[model samples]
Target: MMGLRGINRIVIAVRNLEAAKKLYADMLGATFHDAHWTGAPFGIHVSIAWDAGIELCAPMPGREHDSAVSQFLAHKGEGIVTVFFGVDDADVAVSRAISAGYACFHSLDYSQDEMDQHLGGRFCRYQESYVSSADRCGFGVALARIDRKPG
Candidate 1:
């Protein structure tokens, strides 16, 4: 069993990251970090607006066809791709989700060192698992556990 804290963030797949960020900022009065984050493994460029709990993602250049963001845009055309739930343990959440008959399609684990190098020590450990419940729930779900360093 896993205790889900709350909605961590809602990821939106978009054709243009900049335009989407601007749109979200204007619409929701959101503020996003100036520096964009790239998930090379997923082949997507990501931008997160912490205050609004929104994340915008787009396919990376030259990896458009192979990226999940691109595929989602091609099929659905810029919409909510995944809603992430905050959990105490992502692995436990994923296992529970699987036991409940959900299919997990992607997972990632980042260690403290990796987080320090990539995220500037803001986060210590980050783990996530994306579960597909689209057929039943009409949307994708993701479980995540993020450990932030103390200020």
Candidate 2:
């Protein structure tokens, strides 16, 4: 059985990316890096706050209606969308969550193509799986395994 080591990251969905960035920066006194567009496929852009390791995401304008970030914003407004936890092994954690009766609602692994295009040709191996909110007291929780070798 897999266990969550700790929280690795928190994903926040916002309606206005700039406004949210400014707000978080002021509140945390943090600096940020260049924005990353997960592209037309994900229809979102994200800015990572290095100090807090929090990712601020907002849906791309044209795709707002269909993007997951938009959906989250609609459902819960400007707040945390999900929490990603670090695990020893993603596959094992998934199996354990399933065996414990939590359904896997979403799964994402950084693909080679995505790494190449979005990460400036650097490879970052990571897998994340979300357990259904129903099983986690209505809060979305994700388990992730990151091969922190390099990016």
Candidate lDDT scores, in order, read 0.83, 0.76
lDDT by residue for model 1 (2-90), tens: 88889989988888888988899999999876334446678888888878988888888887899867767888888998898999988
41-92 in candidate 2: lDDT tens per residue? 6888787764686878888888778886776777778888778788988999
Query: Which of the numbered candidates is closest to the native, going by highest lDDT?
Result: 1
State in Å the error of residue 42, model 2: 3.1
**What is the overall TM-score of model 2 with all chains considered together?**
0.78
lDDT of 1 at 115: 79
TM agreement with the true structure for every prediction = 0.86, 0.78
Model 1 poorest ten-residue lDDT run: 32-41
